[model samples]
Target: MRGALGVFIVRPNPDAGWSLSDADNGEVLVFESGGQAERLAMALARQAHATHGAGEVWVYDRLDRIVGRWRVAAVGMALADVDETAKAA
Candidate 1:
Protein backbone atom coordinates (compact mmCIF):
# COMPACT_ATOMS: atom_id res chain seq x y z
CA MET A 1 0.00 0.00 0.00
CA ARG A 2 3.05 2.23 0.34
CA GLY A 3 6.70 2.17 -0.77
CA ALA A 4 8.18 -0.99 -2.30
CA LEU A 5 4.89 -2.81 -2.05
CA GLY A 6 4.83 -6.34 -3.43
CA VAL A 7 2.61 -9.27 -4.16
CA PHE A 8 4.68 -12.41 -3.80
CA ILE A 9 4.17 -15.80 -5.34
CA VAL A 10 5.13 -18.70 -3.14
CA ARG A 11 4.62 -22.42 -2.79
CA PRO A 12 3.40 -23.58 0.56
CA ASN A 13 4.80 -26.86 1.92
CA PRO A 14 1.56 -28.79 1.55
CA ASP A 15 0.48 -27.51 -1.87
CA ALA A 16 1.71 -28.84 -5.24
CA GLY A 17 1.62 -25.60 -7.23
CA TRP A 18 1.83 -21.88 -6.51
CA SER A 19 0.36 -19.57 -3.89
CA LEU A 20 -0.19 -15.80 -3.89
CA SER A 21 0.09 -13.18 -1.14
CA ASP A 22 0.68 -9.57 -0.40
CA ALA A 23 3.86 -8.76 1.49
CA ASP A 24 1.64 -7.29 4.17
CA ASN A 25 -0.13 -10.66 4.49
CA GLY A 26 1.46 -13.98 3.67
CA GLU A 27 0.06 -16.88 1.60
CA VAL A 28 -3.46 -16.25 0.45
CA LEU A 29 -4.36 -18.81 -2.23
CA VAL A 30 -2.96 -22.25 -2.87
CA PHE A 31 -3.63 -22.47 -6.58
CA GLU A 32 -3.47 -25.46 -8.89
CA SER A 33 -0.80 -24.44 -11.44
CA GLY A 34 2.08 -22.02 -11.83
CA GLY A 35 0.69 -20.46 -15.01
CA GLN A 36 -2.74 -20.02 -13.52
CA ALA A 37 -1.44 -18.53 -10.32
CA GLU A 38 1.00 -16.14 -11.91
CA ARG A 39 -1.57 -14.87 -14.41
CA LEU A 40 -4.04 -14.16 -11.66
CA ALA A 41 -1.34 -12.40 -9.65
CA MET A 42 -0.46 -10.28 -12.67
CA ALA A 43 -4.06 -9.21 -13.12
CA LEU A 44 -4.38 -8.42 -9.45
CA ALA A 45 -1.16 -6.41 -9.47
CA ARG A 46 -2.26 -4.42 -12.51
CA GLN A 47 -5.58 -3.66 -10.90
CA ALA A 48 -3.90 -2.55 -7.72
CA HIS A 49 -1.57 -0.35 -9.70
CA ALA A 50 -4.53 1.21 -11.46
CA THR A 51 -6.43 1.87 -8.25
CA HIS A 52 -3.72 2.37 -5.63
CA GLY A 53 -0.34 3.07 -7.22
CA ALA A 54 2.63 1.53 -8.99
CA GLY A 55 4.21 -1.49 -7.31
CA GLU A 56 5.84 -4.82 -8.10
CA VAL A 57 5.02 -8.49 -8.38
CA TRP A 58 7.35 -11.43 -7.97
CA VAL A 59 6.63 -14.92 -9.17
CA TYR A 60 7.95 -18.19 -7.78
CA ASP A 61 7.69 -21.86 -8.52
CA ARG A 62 6.57 -24.78 -6.40
CA LEU A 63 10.15 -25.43 -5.36
CA ASP A 64 10.46 -21.87 -4.03
CA ARG A 65 12.47 -20.74 -7.04
CA ILE A 66 11.87 -17.19 -8.22
CA VAL A 67 10.54 -16.84 -11.75
CA GLY A 68 10.91 -13.10 -12.28
CA ARG A 69 9.87 -9.65 -11.10
CA TRP A 70 7.12 -7.70 -12.83
CA ARG A 71 6.64 -3.95 -12.78
CA VAL A 72 3.08 -2.96 -12.14
CA ALA A 73 2.86 0.29 -14.01
CA ALA A 74 0.54 3.17 -13.15
CA VAL A 75 1.83 6.13 -15.17
CA GLY A 76 5.47 7.26 -15.22
CA MET A 77 8.75 5.46 -14.57
CA ALA A 78 9.50 3.20 -11.61
CA LEU A 79 10.20 4.92 -8.28
CA ALA A 80 13.78 3.71 -8.16
CA ASP A 81 14.35 4.96 -11.67
CA VAL A 82 12.94 8.34 -10.73
CA ASP A 83 15.24 8.50 -7.73
CA GLU A 84 18.23 7.70 -9.92
CA THR A 85 17.24 10.40 -12.40
CA ALA A 86 16.92 12.98 -9.65
CA LYS A 87 20.32 12.05 -8.25
CA ALA A 88 21.86 12.56 -11.70
CA ALA A 89 20.31 16.04 -12.06
Candidate 2:
Protein backbone atom coordinates (compact mmCIF):
# COMPACT_ATOMS: atom_id res chain seq x y z
CA MET A 1 0.00 0.00 0.00
CA ARG A 2 1.18 3.47 -0.87
CA GLY A 3 0.05 6.85 0.38
CA ALA A 4 0.85 10.35 -0.71
CA LEU A 5 0.54 13.77 0.88
CA GLY A 6 0.45 16.73 -1.44
CA VAL A 7 0.90 20.45 -0.97
CA PHE A 8 -0.73 22.31 -3.81
CA ILE A 9 -0.80 25.99 -4.64
CA VAL A 10 -4.17 27.64 -4.47
CA ARG A 11 -5.65 31.00 -5.52
CA PRO A 12 -3.30 31.77 -8.35
CA ASN A 13 -4.14 35.39 -7.86
CA PRO A 14 -2.30 37.88 -5.68
CA ASP A 15 -3.57 36.12 -2.57
CA ALA A 16 -2.09 32.79 -3.61
CA GLY A 17 -1.54 30.22 -0.91
CA TRP A 18 -0.85 26.50 -0.54
CA SER A 19 -3.15 23.54 0.02
CA LEU A 20 -2.40 20.29 1.76
CA SER A 21 -4.36 17.11 1.15
CA ASP A 22 -4.16 13.35 1.13
CA ALA A 23 -5.34 10.72 -1.32
CA ASP A 24 -7.16 8.85 1.41
CA ASN A 25 -8.93 11.84 2.91
CA GLY A 26 -10.95 14.71 1.62
CA GLU A 27 -9.91 17.14 4.33
CA VAL A 28 -7.71 19.99 3.14
CA LEU A 29 -5.65 22.71 4.78
CA VAL A 30 -4.71 25.96 3.19
CA PHE A 31 -1.87 28.24 4.21
CA GLU A 32 -0.79 31.70 3.19
CA SER A 33 2.90 30.81 3.07
CA GLY A 34 4.92 28.09 1.35
CA GLY A 35 6.86 27.56 4.57
CA GLN A 36 3.67 26.57 6.31
CA ALA A 37 2.85 24.14 3.55
CA GLU A 38 6.33 22.68 3.67
CA ARG A 39 6.07 22.35 7.42
CA LEU A 40 2.87 20.41 7.13
CA ALA A 41 4.33 18.23 4.40
CA MET A 42 7.31 17.48 6.62
CA ALA A 43 5.00 16.50 9.43
CA LEU A 44 2.95 14.27 7.17
CA ALA A 45 6.06 12.72 5.71
CA ARG A 46 7.35 11.90 9.17
CA GLN A 47 4.02 10.44 10.21
CA ALA A 48 3.92 8.32 7.08
CA HIS A 49 7.45 7.13 7.64
CA ALA A 50 6.71 6.02 11.17
CA THR A 51 3.38 4.47 10.31
CA HIS A 52 3.72 3.18 6.75
CA GLY A 53 7.49 3.04 6.35
CA ALA A 54 7.17 4.66 2.95
CA GLY A 55 5.33 7.56 1.40
CA GLU A 56 5.60 10.68 -0.68
CA VAL A 57 5.10 14.42 -0.22
CA TRP A 58 4.64 16.74 -3.13
CA VAL A 59 4.21 20.42 -3.93
CA TYR A 60 2.25 21.59 -6.94
CA ASP A 61 1.32 24.86 -8.51
CA ARG A 62 -2.17 26.22 -9.06
CA LEU A 63 -2.21 24.43 -12.37
CA ASP A 64 -1.82 21.11 -10.61
CA ARG A 65 1.69 20.78 -12.00
CA ILE A 66 4.14 19.18 -9.65
CA VAL A 67 6.88 21.56 -8.54
CA GLY A 68 8.62 19.66 -5.79
CA ARG A 69 8.63 16.36 -3.97
CA TRP A 70 10.07 14.46 -1.01
CA ARG A 71 9.99 10.70 -0.73
CA VAL A 72 11.18 8.07 1.71
CA ALA A 73 14.80 8.77 0.79
CA ALA A 74 14.46 12.31 2.10
CA VAL A 75 12.41 11.48 5.15
CA GLY A 76 15.22 12.54 7.42
CA MET A 77 14.94 16.07 6.19
CA ALA A 78 11.24 15.96 6.79
CA LEU A 79 11.75 16.50 10.46
CA ALA A 80 11.26 20.12 11.41
CA ASP A 81 14.31 22.28 11.91
CA VAL A 82 15.08 23.81 15.29
CA ASP A 83 15.98 27.43 15.83
CA GLU A 84 18.53 28.71 18.30
CA THR A 85 19.23 32.17 19.60
CA ALA A 86 22.21 33.52 21.56
CA LYS A 87 22.47 36.56 23.84
CA ALA A 88 25.76 38.42 23.79
CA ALA A 89 24.73 41.39 25.85
Candidate 3:
Protein backbone atom coordinates (compact mmCIF):
# COMPACT_ATOMS: atom_id res chain seq x y z
CA MET A 1 0.00 0.00 0.00
CA ARG A 2 2.98 2.32 0.40
CA GLY A 3 4.46 2.39 -3.09
CA ALA A 4 1.74 0.84 -5.16
CA LEU A 5 0.65 2.82 -8.21
CA GLY A 6 -2.66 1.03 -8.20
CA VAL A 7 -4.36 -1.16 -5.61
CA PHE A 8 -7.26 -3.50 -6.24
CA ILE A 9 -9.21 -5.63 -3.79
CA VAL A 10 -11.44 -8.64 -4.37
CA ARG A 11 -13.94 -9.56 -1.73
CA PRO A 12 -17.38 -11.04 -1.28
CA ASN A 13 -20.39 -8.83 -1.91
CA PRO A 14 -22.90 -8.36 0.86
CA ASP A 15 -25.89 -9.33 -1.22
CA ALA A 16 -24.36 -11.99 -3.44
CA GLY A 17 -21.43 -12.89 -5.69
CA TRP A 18 -18.00 -11.24 -5.47
CA SER A 19 -16.84 -7.69 -5.76
CA LEU A 20 -13.64 -6.21 -7.12
CA SER A 21 -12.77 -2.68 -6.26
CA ASP A 22 -10.03 -0.38 -7.44
CA ALA A 23 -8.74 1.13 -4.26
CA ASP A 24 -7.11 4.04 -6.04
CA ASN A 25 -9.95 4.92 -8.38
CA GLY A 26 -13.03 3.96 -6.43
CA GLU A 27 -14.36 1.77 -9.17
CA VAL A 28 -16.22 -1.42 -8.42
CA LEU A 29 -17.02 -4.51 -10.46
CA VAL A 30 -19.06 -7.54 -9.58
CA PHE A 31 -18.60 -11.13 -10.65
CA GLU A 32 -20.56 -14.29 -10.16
CA SER A 33 -17.70 -16.11 -8.49
CA GLY A 34 -14.68 -15.31 -6.35
CA GLY A 35 -12.40 -16.89 -8.95
CA GLN A 36 -13.71 -14.61 -11.66
CA ALA A 37 -13.39 -11.53 -9.50
CA GLU A 38 -9.83 -12.45 -8.52
CA ARG A 39 -8.85 -13.12 -12.13
CA LEU A 40 -10.12 -9.74 -13.28
CA ALA A 41 -8.45 -7.99 -10.40
CA MET A 42 -5.09 -9.54 -11.30
CA ALA A 43 -5.53 -8.64 -14.95
CA LEU A 44 -6.32 -5.04 -14.08
CA ALA A 45 -3.33 -4.87 -11.76
CA ARG A 46 -1.06 -6.18 -14.50
CA GLN A 47 -2.38 -3.55 -16.90
CA ALA A 48 -1.84 -0.84 -14.31
CA HIS A 49 1.73 -2.03 -13.75
CA ALA A 50 2.44 -2.02 -17.47
CA THR A 51 1.05 1.49 -17.81
CA HIS A 52 1.96 3.27 -14.59
CA GLY A 53 4.76 1.12 -13.08
CA ALA A 54 3.59 -0.75 -9.98
CA GLY A 55 0.36 -2.33 -8.86
CA GLU A 56 -1.11 -4.65 -6.24
CA VAL A 57 -4.04 -7.03 -6.05
CA TRP A 58 -5.47 -8.31 -2.78
CA VAL A 59 -8.02 -11.10 -2.55
CA TYR A 60 -10.06 -11.69 0.57
CA ASP A 61 -12.17 -14.65 1.57
CA ARG A 62 -15.83 -14.58 2.64
CA LEU A 63 -14.77 -13.99 6.19
CA ASP A 64 -12.60 -11.03 5.14
CA ARG A 65 -9.32 -12.89 5.51
CA ILE A 66 -6.51 -12.15 3.13
CA VAL A 67 -6.34 -15.27 0.99
CA GLY A 68 -4.21 -14.19 -1.96
CA ARG A 69 -1.98 -11.33 -3.08
CA TRP A 70 -0.09 -10.25 -6.16
CA ARG A 71 2.39 -7.47 -6.56
CA VAL A 72 3.43 -6.16 -9.94
CA ALA A 73 6.79 -4.39 -9.96
CA ALA A 74 7.92 -1.42 -12.02
CA VAL A 75 10.35 -3.64 -13.90
CA GLY A 76 7.47 -5.38 -15.69
CA MET A 77 7.59 -8.35 -13.38
CA ALA A 78 5.00 -9.72 -10.99
CA LEU A 79 5.00 -11.82 -7.83
CA ALA A 80 1.96 -13.91 -6.96
CA ASP A 81 2.88 -14.56 -3.36
CA VAL A 82 0.58 -14.41 -0.36
CA ASP A 83 2.39 -12.58 2.38
CA GLU A 84 0.87 -13.71 5.64
CA THR A 85 2.35 -10.69 7.35
CA ALA A 86 0.26 -8.30 5.24
CA LYS A 87 -2.65 -6.86 7.14
CA ALA A 88 -5.43 -4.59 5.92
CA ALA A 89 -5.07 -1.07 7.16
Candidate 4:
Protein backbone atom coordinates (compact mmCIF):
# COMPACT_ATOMS: atom_id res chain seq x y z
CA MET A 1 0.00 0.00 0.00
CA ARG A 2 2.56 2.48 1.17
CA GLY A 3 5.29 3.06 -1.34
CA ALA A 4 5.71 6.61 -2.66
CA LEU A 5 3.98 9.96 -2.44
CA GLY A 6 1.96 10.30 -5.61
CA VAL A 7 -1.46 10.47 -7.11
CA PHE A 8 -3.85 7.52 -7.34
CA ILE A 9 -6.71 7.51 -9.78
CA VAL A 10 -9.92 5.49 -9.61
CA ARG A 11 -11.47 5.32 -13.06
CA PRO A 12 -13.96 3.23 -14.90
CA ASN A 13 -12.64 0.37 -16.97
CA PRO A 14 -13.67 0.57 -20.62
CA ASP A 15 -14.91 -3.00 -20.80
CA ALA A 16 -16.13 -3.53 -17.27
CA GLY A 17 -16.07 -2.45 -13.62
CA TRP A 18 -13.54 -0.05 -12.15
CA SER A 19 -9.80 0.33 -11.85
CA LEU A 20 -7.35 2.03 -9.51
CA SER A 21 -4.01 3.11 -10.91
CA ASP A 22 -0.90 4.57 -9.43
CA ALA A 23 -0.11 7.65 -11.47
CA ASP A 24 3.54 7.32 -10.63
CA ASN A 25 4.10 3.74 -11.64
CA GLY A 26 1.22 2.82 -13.95
CA GLU A 27 0.27 -0.05 -11.61
CA VAL A 28 -3.39 -0.90 -11.94
CA LEU A 29 -5.95 -2.83 -9.90
CA VAL A 30 -9.43 -3.73 -10.99
CA PHE A 31 -12.53 -3.84 -8.79
CA GLU A 32 -16.11 -4.87 -9.34
CA SER A 33 -17.50 -1.48 -8.36
CA GLY A 34 -16.53 2.16 -8.27
CA GLY A 35 -17.06 2.21 -4.52
CA GLN A 36 -14.64 -0.63 -4.04
CA ALA A 37 -12.02 0.95 -6.27
CA GLU A 38 -12.43 4.32 -4.59
CA ARG A 39 -12.20 2.88 -1.11
CA LEU A 40 -8.97 1.07 -1.92
CA ALA A 41 -7.57 4.16 -3.63
CA MET A 42 -8.28 6.24 -0.57
CA ALA A 43 -6.73 3.66 1.71
CA LEU A 44 -3.65 3.51 -0.46
CA ALA A 45 -3.41 7.28 -0.57
CA ARG A 46 -3.67 7.43 3.19
CA GLN A 47 -0.95 4.86 3.55
CA ALA A 48 1.26 6.77 1.14
CA HIS A 49 0.64 9.96 3.06
CA ALA A 50 1.52 8.33 6.34
CA THR A 51 4.64 6.91 4.81
CA HIS A 52 5.74 9.87 2.70
CA GLY A 53 3.89 12.86 4.16
CA ALA A 54 1.68 13.52 1.15
CA GLY A 55 -0.62 11.73 -1.25
CA GLU A 56 -3.67 12.19 -3.46
CA VAL A 57 -6.57 10.20 -4.85
CA TRP A 58 -8.68 11.19 -7.82
CA VAL A 59 -11.90 9.45 -8.65
CA TYR A 60 -13.28 9.59 -12.17
CA ASP A 61 -16.73 8.80 -13.39
CA ARG A 62 -17.72 6.52 -16.25
CA LEU A 63 -17.51 9.50 -18.56
CA ASP A 64 -13.85 9.84 -17.63
CA ARG A 65 -14.41 13.08 -15.81
CA ILE A 66 -12.88 13.63 -12.45
CA VAL A 67 -15.62 13.46 -9.84
CA GLY A 68 -13.77 13.49 -6.56
CA ARG A 69 -10.34 14.29 -5.23
CA TRP A 70 -8.82 13.68 -1.80
CA ARG A 71 -5.48 15.02 -0.72
CA VAL A 72 -3.46 14.35 2.38
CA ALA A 73 -0.99 16.94 3.52
CA ALA A 74 2.11 16.74 5.69
CA VAL A 75 2.28 14.37 8.63
CA GLY A 76 0.05 15.20 11.62
CA MET A 77 -2.19 17.23 9.33
CA ALA A 78 -5.69 16.27 8.32
CA LEU A 79 -5.80 12.82 6.80
CA ALA A 80 -7.81 14.04 3.84
CA ASP A 81 -8.99 17.25 2.28
CA VAL A 82 -11.73 16.65 -0.21
CA ASP A 83 -11.38 19.08 -3.05
CA GLU A 84 -14.71 20.64 -3.94
CA THR A 85 -13.33 21.79 -7.27
CA ALA A 86 -13.12 18.23 -8.47
CA LYS A 87 -16.85 17.80 -7.97
CA ALA A 88 -17.40 20.93 -9.99
CA ALA A 89 -15.34 19.42 -12.77
Top candidate on lDDT is: 3
Q: Write the per-residue lDDT of candidate 1 for residues 40-83, one digit (tens) a residue.
A: 77777777777767555665444555446666765532323433
- Candidate 2 yields a Cα-based lDDT of 0.52
lDDT, candidate 4, residue 20?
93
| Model 1 C-alpha lDDT versus the unseen true structure | 0.57
Best by TM-score: 3
> Sort by TM-score, best first: what order?
3, 4, 1, 2
Residue 9, model 4: Cα distance from true site in angstroms? 0.2
Work out the TM-score per prediction: 0.62, 0.61, 0.78, 0.75
TM-score of candidate 4 versus the correct structure, residues matched by position: 0.75
- Which residue runs of candidate 4 sit more than 4 Å off their true CA positions? 1-4, 73-89
lDDT of 3 by residue, 13-73 (tens): 9889999888876778899998898788878888988888777888778887777777877
Q: Report the candidate with higher TM-score, 1 versus 4.
A: 4
Q: Can you write out model 2's per-residue Cα lDDT over 1-89, one digit (the tens) per residue?
A: 11333322222223567666665565567778777876776677667776767655655556645555555455274421112100100
Shift of residue 67 alpha carbon in model 1, Å: 2.6
lDDT (CA) for every model shown? 0.57, 0.52, 0.77, 0.75
- The superposed Cα distance between candidate 1 and the true structure at residue 21, in angstroms, equals 1.4
Model 3, residue 36: distance off in Å is 1.2
- RMSD of model 1, in Å? 7.1
